[model samples]
Target: MKKFLGALALALALISPVAANPIIIPGDKNQRLIANNLYLTTDSLFAAYMSENLEQRRLAEMYVIGVIASSEGESWCGFKIASPDAVQEQVYIGLKSASEKLPKSRPAAAIKSRLKEILPCKK
Candidate 1:
């Protein structure tokens, strides 16, 4: 038992640093650039969703919905917010409206603000 404990401690000590420090590959920068650019405009967002894999598309759509839901409430844009499907549609329309109204530089903020006019839920 003593030998086993000593070996375990040694193994953990050796592995700890490697576990803590992640390796930054060269492509990580490019990936980050692409992701950052995705949120810059509704066109970019929609293009990425259409071009990326199904999982990526789903995540992008979910991100749009989450932003609207979080900024407002679950009952976003004056929609009933009854189910996921309904919420998704409302989010899509809101995003579309925002994209048309907002400029490219501040897409997220513009979208949020545009939503106020497009779908201001009565308190």
Candidate 2:
């Protein structure tokens, strides 16, 4: 009986982290909603950046700065962007470089992956 109980406990412990969702930083319901919206906006801007209209592409770049600024006010996925300008620069660079590498990925997923590489929280 004790062996069975110990095995069950070990199994639950092993499964828990695998089942857990990535924690939305400093986690709160409101922050999760805001983060989700910001992620969506960033995705849209990425799509617009590919537009043939030069003006549309320029506007999309500008909008990415705004989205990054707003994201600073919400929860992040363990990124540690220091200032608004820094975030803007990082996002701009990510859009330019990372977008090319991930041609087949959804823009939001690609952006998120890029940002994670650029600005992970210090351990």
Candidate 3:
């Protein structure tokens, strides 16, 4: 009985991490929704060009900065932002607009689409 219990504990330990970290494929709707929830919650705090939730805003800014850095020198999102500050402003504005017009829209996707529309790649 002790051996069986030890085996069960080992099995659970092996499975716990896998269960905690579910695979999220790119472009998956559910994955997008989950990712957007984080941004949307933070973006919602923006009021009159400032965020009411500074901590959340800081986190969102970091996330947007990372995305911008990753997209540098590429037309991945078809945006030609000239500066990091510009990119941050655009992302926040895009997120705010998305939250107003399409409250349930995925933020990353929405911001990408918005950037493509307003700041299309100049080729």
Each candidate structure's TM-score, on Cα atoms with residue i matched to residue i, is: 0.46, 0.39, 0.49
For this target, which candidate reaches the highest lDDT against the unseen true structure?
Answer: 3
Q: Write the residue-wise lDDT of candidate 1 on 6-40 in tens digits.
A: 56754564454322211111233334433333434
Error of 3 at 48 (Å): 14
lDDT of 2 by residue, 8-66 (tens): 75455445441131111222333432443334333345555666656656756665555
Scanning candidate 2 in windows of ten residues, the lowest lDDT window is 18-27
Q: RMSD for all candidates, in order, please.
A: 13.0, 15.2, 10.9
Q: RMSD of model 3, in Å?
A: 10.9
Compared with the true structure, what per-residue lDDT tens digits does model 3 show for residues 76-96?
A: 443344465666667777877
Q: Give the least accurate 10-residue stretch of model 1, judged by summed lDDT.
A: 18-27
Off by over 4 Å in 2: 1-47, 50-81
Ranking by TM-score: 3, 1, 2
